[model samples]
Target: ELHLHTDHLNLTCSTFHDVHMIRWRLAIEEFGPTFHSVPGSSNVVADALSRLPITDEELEENPTVTMAAVEAAMSGEFTVDMRVIAAEQKNDKDIGESEEREIAGVLVLVHPKSKKILVPTRLRLRLVQNYHDLLLHPGAATMVITIGQVFYSRGIEPDERKLTDNYLACLKAKHPATRYGKLPPKSVEVCPWFEIADDLIGPYGRKRFRALTIIDTATRLIEILPATDATSMEAAYLMDRYWFARYPRPTRCIHDGGSEFKREFAELQDNYGVERVATMTRNHQANSVIERVHRVIVEKIRTKSINTQDEWANFLNDTMFAMRASNHSMLKVHRLSWHSDVTCWWALPTKQIGKRSINAR
Candidate 1:
């Protein structure tokens, strides 16, 4: 017969309330050993062995230690000593006569007005790596801006770009900067409302509300109307009530192949003499103008709706005003300003078109 001895006084009890203890008892029972309740003083050898220090060789062979070492190397911990930087700064000719300031108990060179630290040449790479990792590996421009907030280094932009370019994780996650093909030349529209694009934005919030998004391609002016559903009748109603009621009727209306733009929507466009141009299936690029605006509008609504997402409709007008007041990337002018300029330009005498028009060819 086998024998077992443990200092745990509860082990000798027949009844075990703990599931783990019961499982251990069942497992030990398989060996057919007699359990003995031993004095705590008799467990000296096992206790001493548990308290023994791990040797270097044992640590080297440990999988946990090896993994920790790998992690430490990858993380590139901050190891630059202030004394070392202070010593090296004296030799760095580029540092010039910059003022040295003791910040947070560490000696660092600081710019007079900006008060930003001037990092030593040898420490810049490690500093950049730590900042890059801490900020979750932002893009080069973002990294420069973040570093500039607290630290100043000459040619830091190129250094940051170089590091990010070589970083394997960043390489796998980031998109290539190269453009695949030449972008098609922009089409010049002389007047606003000549061509327009429309699309539906949501099914967002608790109400499952959606917004009908319409844009004037020439002026980049947008109109957003909230609806309870994405039905053809609702789309037509919003177009009639919001768009056609305010501005001049558009010649062509570009939209996706969704069923919401069919039936009643097609009939409404037909009656109004507006040609309905359905985008090619699965090709959103056909209506890229409105598609781009949709992203901006959704982002704004999402930001404003935060804890009150169910009331996204309440922020629609604010979103519209912000979009109209903001500068258009392509036109390089505010949407409202562009709309006003286009309207006034067309209002001028036809004789002045060739002489004084802003976009005269």
Candidate 2:
């Protein structure tokens, strides 16, 4: 189907009788620049039409105008209202005949049999109809931007207002307040605040006797919750309240299964729309965020704050600030931008000019 040019490899002086070039469109008296080069397809028509500059008045007068008129409409000047367009669907040679015949146009795909290709400039834009449903929520902001213009349509697309509403809606939909996944991709809540991370950070009686510490995973933003009682429920209550006032209730609270981190502390997640759980077959490295945060506090805050505290208020406050100031690669996912790939952390709205102090050490 290459311009019906069969002898593509035949390089010889052409006999006039062998080359019968047929006229495509008599209206195209002068063949303008070739915007596209799919020689055997209708993409040439689409490309030419896209370069046109028709005004609304002209559009009203020539709704059924020729492609040449479209080229005239978009030449040199630009129009904002007339710019949105959808992706052109190219068909394979072996496609079923039952499908709509797609030429150079906007597509209305009802089904395989119900689709029709309309004019390119007359399409509808929309929300991200491309990302997986699971990733269409608040934390997954990249999903929206990734598919913002996807399969570009010309219809009314979601505006900034709807965009925010969509985000909140997805956030509420996925939060544990509504529903939580209860299996492998998400496991069961084992207890309230009792997540176990065993670290041996003492030289009291012996050289290195370890303290098998169990911490409330949720509220440990403040590091040390009171461990006066052997059972962790009392401590879990204090930690649970702190987080209840902040983040969306966690679904799976994780830690190592130590005696103190065990018991019924995981249920605090349920009361505050969370789920607590412990790791069975591993060490402190399993609940490493807490352990890491702990070591950092023990090393830095113990020296900087210039005090040791069984009461964790001071220790926890500085560590919380440090964690926020620190960069996390998982939290700072990246994607292609107009200029370059930008991490999500950098893209976040900067704190107001005279607001919070940022310590990114």
Q: Summarize candidate 1's per-residue lDDT along 11-76 as a digit string, tens digits.
A: 877677995675566445533467798898998876788799989888557624110111112343
Score each candidate by Cα lDDT: 0.67, 0.34
* Clash count for each candidate, listed in order shown: 0, 25
Error of 2 at 66 (Å): 86
How well is each residue in 1-361 modelled by candidate 2, as lDDT tens digits? 0122222223222222332211122111112212222343544655677699979898667654111111111122222121232232223222223334333453332224324322232222222321222121222334333333223322323432354355433332232222111112333232223343332233221122122233334223233332334455654555555444543344455555655454555555456554555564333334555555444333332222112233244434433433433323332312112113324223444342122222221
- Candidate 1: Cα lDDT at 359: 40
Model number with the top lDDT: 1
Q: In model 1, what are the clashing residue pairs, if there are any?
A: none
**Residue ranges of candidate 1 with Cα displaced over 4 Å:** 1-188, 306-310, 340-343, 346-361
Best by TM-score: 1
lDDT of 1 at 17: 93
